[model samples]
Target: MEQVPLNPSRYPTVDYEEVMNSDEGVRKWTDNIYRWGFSLVDGSPATPEATEKLLERIAFIRHTHYGGFWDFTSDLSMKDMAYTTQELGAHTDTTYFTEPAGLQMFHVLSHTGGSGGASLLVDGFAAAQTLYREDPDAYNSLKTVLVNAHASGNEDVCIQPAAPFPILSHHPVTKELCRVQWNIEDRAARMDVDAATLVKWYDAARKFNEVLKRESMERWFQLKPGSPMIFDNWRMLHGRSEFTGKRRVCGAYINRDDFISRYLLLNKGREEVLGKI
Candidate 1:
């Protein structure tokens, strides 16, 4: 077996042969490569049907409001719907939800015109760790505070009331600490903190965002006509670099537990084959 990089530029391309014929091999490969993130077989013409197959092969399929067919041209009205536009800042998808999807796959069907619209991915776990080491107090404050976020203009747009979640959390499967904060624009005012502490909290968060933006902790790539990028939404936060060209894509979400269950079941099958199960 070849050695895996600490951070791979792109996940190794494995044909269905490697993934289906030997469950053990697939488990071992995905475990290591996707510890932080991974991508699947690329270079094939991307389509909604192909995307569904890729997702079904792994485990249960999940969805958000953004799920299903979305055309960048006709969906101009959705631009204000949060995360509908091609221009997006670094954020974990649907952090406001009580239970955000653990994994996300974005399939790009076409990109006609776009300059600097490359997808940006940052290691949120790594970034949070850095903050914890440098500014423990700020980190603790974020974890303790309850963040409120709601869509403006549309009253029905407000969702799930307010929920308290740590900016940093332990991954339910990997047990690694990961960053969870998303949607900075809709964050409600902090009510518990005094004026001084609130100011400090905002400042710390601002600084962290700035550092994350400028830091070299990101890997960039443009989704070609036939490739889909699979990401660990809990551990990796993604965004677009902003582009004017027409970009059409479909996205779906899956839970972390579902991913682990599928992965472990495959591993068990492998172990049984090896007489170790």
Candidate 2:
């Protein structure tokens, strides 16, 4: 298949045949279909065992209690979450984590009572690179800024210790640039800077954000009943469109290194068999 550029209007439907049969094929397919992520097999599994088997193939499994099975909740710590009355703005998950997980999978257990809750993905690596090329100083400033994210409620509900991280980072495996900053709900208190420098930094960040939003390079897809969406959490940022009614999803996070290792190991086994032939 010819490669498709990331564009919301021209997004292509990924065929199941290309995704489920083999690791190598899936890798190539993911490179093309998502250029950022992939949507895998959908349809009610024949049995619970099949569901477990499919889930096992993935690297991680996780959930959030604040959002129930059908909860359409936003990551409340970010300012963009405030602008969004119904939909989440584009962003990578867990920028606060010291080492953010590389991949994320969302299984759509059900989506009956809603409409317009589509998943939106943007190539953060691509966006950051664009910023680097167009505004190097701004990009550099973003890299140095230590973002602080926290919550003050119950220990379980509040983010502990106010995690701090850079706004941009190089991908551990691909070495590609990826955006690591998100929702400006909280600022790092530990970072001490002159008033003038702080204002300049915020201005630069705002400019970079405008560039990302105006680029029109986002891919949008709806997770309907039975289909699960798997994405490179490190490379692509994800968001959801607002919708009425209920929208429940099951999610899991797997280390990117783990997935790459599995992919490589499976390929090595194939190479060994071919050598005998």
Model 1 TM-score, all chains together: 0.80
lDDT of each: 0.65, 0.58
lDDT of 1 by residue, 118-232 (tens): 7877777667777778888877776666676554434446654446676676657886665566567656665566888778778778766875786576677677666677788
**Model 2 CA deviation exceeding 4 Å by range:** 1-35, 42-52, 60-85, 151-163, 171-179, 185-190, 267-277
Please state the error at residue 226 of candidate 2 in Å.
2.5
lDDT of 2 by residue, 163-254 (tens): 46667865678865654556554444555667876777787789777866764756678766556666777767777788666555555566
Off by over 4 Å in 1: 1-13, 16-29, 67-74, 79-86, 151-156, 170-179, 268-277
Weakest 10 consecutive residues, lDDT, candidate 1? 1-10
**Residue 112: error of model 2 in Å?**
2.9
RMSD after Cα superposition, model 1: 4.4
